[model samples]
Target: MNRLAILSVSDKTGLIDLARVLVESYQFQLISSGGTAKALKEANLPVTKVSDYTGAPEILGGRVKTLHPKIHGGILSRPDLESDRADLTANDIQPVTLVVVNLYPFEQTIAKAGVSLEQAIEQIDVGGPTMIRAAAKNHQYVSVLSNPAQYNAYLEELKAHNGETRIEFRRSLALAAFSHTQAYDRAIADYLTKEILNEAQAKIDLMEVSSTGATSSQPSLSSSYTLLCHSPKPLRYGENPHQPATWYQLGAAPKGWSAAQQLQGKELSYNNLLDLEAARSIVAEFWNDAPCAVIVKHNNPCGVAIAPTIAEAYQKAFAADSTSAFGGIVALNRPIDEETAKALTSTFLECVVAPACVASVATILAAKPNLRVLVLPEMQQGTSETVKLIAGGMLVQKSDDLPATPETWQVVTQKQPSPEQMQELIFAWKICRHVKSNAIAITGDRVTLGIGAGQMNRVGSAKIALEQAGDRTKGAVLASDGFFPFDDSVRTAAAAGITAIVQPGGSMRDGDSIKAADELGLVMVLTHVRHFLH
Candidate 1:
């Protein structure tokens, strides 16, 4: 009896070649179903239709074609066991040696612009995953291939071992098959979660308008969900040298940092990625504004500025705190030009990311061989949900990406800010939200003068930021992430020459701070929304 190979796939990328090799060179019998069988016959390769081999007609619109006992028994049988061999022989089933299968395009179907739920459900593969899992679970007796990219390697393995695959090679292929099914299941679960939640919200909106009963409570988060990550790339180390680290991409398709184009420099470390995300978030806040630049150190924005020219923005941001800017991560809203590239090379930095760069900018940046440069055009796009890991389980929440509405803010002081001061306050508030609490940021002329973050007390943070600004605090504005519980910070800001202040005003003693601002002739604006990043 000839060894049998089953070929069933939704993506027929390398199917013809693999089938031909198996039939002509290895003398293995081929069995296929539906479109795969049609494709093999069209390619002039000999194959046995799965229905013909199993002696059962395909039922339920081809959904029950491969769920027969003959197909699964052949795949799960043990050749060394007497009972298994007897069952196979009694049923006249050929023991399957190779199984090649790939799942349907469920992810692609849902990614369509206006795909309906029924359309997505129809694309979900049932028999395919079943066949794959069975083959993977019986890896000791069979070899399974779940991806088109594995075909060439499978051929190489067969050739290396004299027309047979080694046990270890089969084990690795089984692992790949299991991972493929797992990722497919996760995608389906996530899509259903979103769809079900949106549907529930729509019904609630309908009820609120029609019914006279008490209002319904908001829908809570899903009780459980799965997260799948693939393509693990090893890194040098994590935050410290002793800790090992690896980068795992979230999905099969790359986006965000995984899709970044690295123009030059060495690989990014764990800390570099963290700082880069912080820098990206800060720069994203000013994407619609003028040319903007942000410099981050230890995952906190040390400098952020917007200027008429990209080079000027970078220069002013660097001038915000030159000492801390050293070896910091940089993110820019505009493309890098000649002047900006020249200024960038003058300093030793860890990384620089931008929307794009001129053709000549690469050569200019070549001076710093160790600087990791990246280009991500869609810098404004971010994850809708943020996930954090705690002791045993993880926490999930909506990302704090609300827009800044300075127009809705109220003037809580006797002195009102000028138009220029209002713009400065808006800029300061946008940057303040990204800083770690207790956070305080001072800005002048649309550039960060000084930022104090992660302090124990609000007053300590204000003092650090004011002292960093020094003389620049004259005519500058200050923005705080939270409300001030006391008037000491307000008095201190006025004494440091801060002309305007912006903060969320929900504190019990807010009147004390307002009275101090009025007495000192300083402008105070209350936004009514507090942003605390810990």
Candidate 2:
């Protein structure tokens, strides 16, 4: 009695090789479906189509192929139980020892541009996941393989065990199969929710055709969320030395923080990753062919600047707050040239992350043994939901990837801002958006003079920012993450000699703040875009 092996897969990565080995080395009967059957037949291997084995033709566009009792009975039969043995004999079902299957490319299909809902629905492999789950659930008597990469080792194991697979290997393959199906279903669910939200947004746009410039797109609620967690690599230490940590990658393709490849330096610490993310997020805002640099300390932007050249940007960003730049994370929008690398190496920086680095420049940074150099092309543009863990459940939200413009703000003050003042205010607004709650950013000449973040009160943050600006506060502009609840902040800014201010004006006493600005001879702009980063 030859053991039966079911080979049904959408991905033909190692189908022929695995089929030939199972047939020749292991002496197993090949049972395949659809494309897998076609490929195996082309290889001149003796194969039985799943429909032929089940005596049921695939109907309803091949959706009804593997849902038959004959196909599942073989994989699910328990040879130990008398009832299970009788059922298998009554159905003339042979025990299926191996199931080589992989799900359809649902994620890749939907990721393509201009894909339709119907098209994506078709790509959702109904029978593939069904078979995978069935085999995985009955892993005691069945072996499941979902990835083609498992072929060589599985063949080796069978060859070693005299055409028999161990329970441990079978259980691991079952786990992999289950993970594959879960990820597939998750991709389909996420894509469907996205489509529904897009359609809903389209309807809203149709209803409010006049409301064009508002925040049109938001991540809508989905039924379920799934993350394919894998690739666990050990780290030196966690946030603290006593705590243990391991780095895990989510999904197959690398993006954002997961995409960073460290080139030169000591091993990355837990705090190092946090600062890197903050710097990357900030610099990504100015990644549009501009030379922008951001210096981050403890997950807050201490210095940020944009200049004609990357070296100049790094210089201006460093000059913004030299005290905080020491031992801080540096992120650049442009590649590090020789000049920029030399300038960066001059500082006592912790890490330098960019899209690319010249070989010689990487060598120049190599001179600093402790400086971590990371190259991440995905930093330029990528979309991912922000998920944070709480006490019992999780909080999911859309990332604040909204684009800002100087034109969107309303000039509310009697003393309207000058053209340069508006530009300065917009630049300040962009930085303030990323700062912690009760944040204040003071800027002049396209650079941050000072930032007061995570203060308990808006006035306290404003005072700190103004004081940090010091002499520069006389001509600098100010931006607040939220609207000032009281007029005292306005008075404080004006007293600091701040010329212009930008904030989201939604407070009940907006008139009082406006009156204070008017009385103090100050220019104020209301962005109506409150960015409270708590």
TM, every model = 0.93, 0.88
Local accuracy of candidate 1 as per-residue lDDT tens digits, 215-330: 66556655676677877889899999999999988876778899999999999999999999999999999999999999999999999999999999999999999999999999
Off by over 4 Å in 1: 59-61, 156-162, 165-169, 209-214, 217-221
Winning candidate number (lDDT) = 1
Question: Model 2's lDDT to the true fold?
Answer: 0.86
Q: In candidate 1, where is summed lDDT lowest over 10 consecutive residues?
A: 213-222
For model 2, the stretches where C-alpha displacement exceeds 4 angstroms are 14-25, 41-46, 57-64, 149-169, 207-221, 228-234, 244-252, 260-262, 266-269, 382-384
Count the clashes in each prediction: 0, 0
Candidate 2 per-residue lDDT over residues 305-351, each given as its tens digit: 98899999999999989999999999998888999999999979999
